[model samples]
Target: MSDSQLAKLPTSGMRRWQLTPKIRLTSVQATLADDLELRGEGDAHLSLVIMCEGAGWFRLNRQAIQHYCADSFWLSCASGRCQGYDFFPRHHFYHLLIVDFSPELLTLVEECGLRVPGDEPKVFSAALAEPLKAAMLEIQQGWNEASPLAALHLESLALNALWLALGQLQTQQEARPQPTASRLPSRERKRLIAARDVIRQQASEPLSIEEMARTAGLSLMAFKRGFRAMFGITPWNYVIECRLKLAQNLLEESALPLSDIALRCGFAHASHLTRFFQRQYGQPPGRYRSSCQQVRMAG
Candidate 1:
């Protein structure tokens, strides 16, 4: 159906917000008197829908799926078939954030080695994980920020949400055995572990790669290669990962200011911490802390 036709659907209420030419974000808040059935247009696009607050059932094809508040669903709208949702009457309102993108967006995701699943248009029920929830909230809040940055933030958050969505699918499968890669020499391995331990222990203090190398008893180049072989990530990335994870745990468990958290996590300053935190998790430290706290309180 066209936009105008969709707006006239016999639902309680619906609204669509256009973010870009081919990208649309929608909000649906409906209080139904009966099972409200709605159908999709079967457009060739991708969609990420978050059930912010609601209880509803969606029937796509022959499958009936239930959704709760905080649940998410990813839709691949390439099939040219009608998709439907059934929302029951509720005293409280049901809210949804629907992010729709053109088929071209998948090209970008595929180039990044993160392909959204499903060939035909389908809705896979998702429970928005903590990190993804942060991204969604940031995108929502970004709407209030100034021009270019708001667009940029939405783009980043969309990609981050896609990555997390794919990751969630990966986690649903059972584990399988895989061929093991060759291991580093026993002594070299010990040295690498020792180096990692040193980094972990001194993450809150100023520590150098040279210090880590000396502790590992290897030259800098060798240390880098060996560490990558052992850890599957660069030594620098590993150091940042350690510090960030520490900072993340502290943020979740404590009520510390950014400056204090930065100092405790070995960052040069709160701004420095904010820069890397946003790079690593797509949000600043404060936003991440708030998202985590909200999740904690809800749980």
Candidate 2:
């Protein structure tokens, strides 16, 4: 893949690289001059698009128009003859990265026991996880490195990202309800989803279980039961997870003091962040930041 091939899109700048025969990476930095609709027709493949900074709408095979924003992503798998329209607003600056996995790579994934979502064409969106976000940023930064080993380095990063993405998809698949099993009522499920979104959007704030339950319009006991049944984790634990994810992103992307990062991510102090950071990621915040810096410098 190359910029010449991507010239059809209304991008101010574009770059594409073939990481391997089975995997290709492309990054686009664009300020659209007008509303644009882009289409695709292709053979079997899986694509993961990471929206680093942008807002757009896309639909596959005339499905619902799905909106994507900065710090989010969408994954699509098509067997053959897939069609989609990607719409970008006029004059909006957006930076996004796309990674395409060829059919051989999908075969390898299945051989490794991680099933692709389904045989039929499908697309889904989700919030990008901290580690995956870190990986994608590294790929973008290292895309033009002059080092002789850059290709190898990028291949490794691309694989790491694909693994993380597939893991998320698998988790989502497992969370879906089975046809024969009992399921949460639609109204209750929507409330629970709203409550979950609240945690994700406001992880830095001091939130209480009671407050979250109220947000879901359910009593505390019922809230806890329904939340756990639907999401497979306690509400409080989910809060912690959200906070930690924010902390991880800050550690990788910013130069803020550990104490400041801790407070920003809802931790009480630097030590509190260090404790949970170590338990979850096997390292302290300072060390993690240093490691990220080293990778950037190496690139």
Candidate 3:
């Protein structure tokens, strides 16, 4: 088959379920009521599942069932072992199946590579349910039929499905609504919230308490007191934390130069950035990048 066609099918080794450095594809299946279990005596690979309809339960390793209902999906694999999982199928529950794209996707991180940033695995999204469900159905059908190019066909569809699922997860995280406290005085709350938004929006700028207070329409002293009471941090500390977070993202998402990263994130200079980054992350940016690059290379 052609390269494009190959992209649609599972790599030849997929059936072994040894999704190692080579696989960048996701598998599919459905879930149902009751519990599913997977037993493993070894440790390796990446796995996950999403519940499209019902709830999933687990310990630390193993899943209860392989052939489940139309539940969305669940992801499980070796991170560490001596564990398992359990799920409660709702009255009408469904889920899908997916495996790791391998830790190797870190290679796609460009010249900089995936930063040695923390791995944050969040829940899959509801918005992707329909398309992903359809893709899983196709995979199921192809498997049952034992189609000539079953792996090839599933590969492309699975890639598209995974991309859609990840896209939804990203959007959901970015769109997470900040909580508001109704019990707090509205003016104080608005002012504090407004300051928080300003810090979030202009984290790279050298923001001062006075400036943030102005944005919040509160006097500087009042803003400081209210902010501390609300957020438990002085404005300067909060701003620095915000800038550090943004810097972290830039380091992970882009191959920007250290000098540029420092300036863009409002650090006094590259050396200053290095000091803070080292203290916070326990390594300088360059070192962290190299570490991740090494991990990818080894994989």
Give candidate 3's whole-model lDDT.
0.53
Error (Å) of candidate 2 at residue 283 is 28
Better of 2 and 3 by lDDT: 2
Q: Name the top TM-score candidate.
A: 2
lDDT (Cα, tens digit) per residue for candidate 3, span 129-161: 677667656654555444447666666665665
Per-residue error for 37 in candidate 1, Å, reads: 3.0
In TM-score terms, candidate 3 sits at 0.38
In angstroms, give how far residue 71 of model 1 lies from its true place: 3.5
lDDT, candidates in the order shown: 0.64, 0.76, 0.53
For model 3, give the 10-residue run with minimal summed lDDT: 108-117
Task: Give TM-scores for every candidate, taking all chains together and pairing residue i with residue i.
Answer: 0.47, 0.54, 0.38
| Per-residue lDDT of candidate 2, residues 110-170 (tens digit) | 3222323343466656788898899999999998885659989998898888888877765
In model 3, what lDDT does residue 44 have? 38
* lDDT measured at residue 234 in model 3 versus the true structure, 0 to 100: 57
RMSD, one per candidate, in order: 15.8, 16.2, 14.8
- TM-score between model 1 and native: 0.47
Clashes of each: 0, 0, 45
Off by over 4 Å in 3: 1-44, 50-56, 61-71, 74-82, 87-96, 106-128, 144-148, 178-299
Model 2 TM-score (2 dp): 0.54
TM-score-superior candidate, 2 or 3: 2
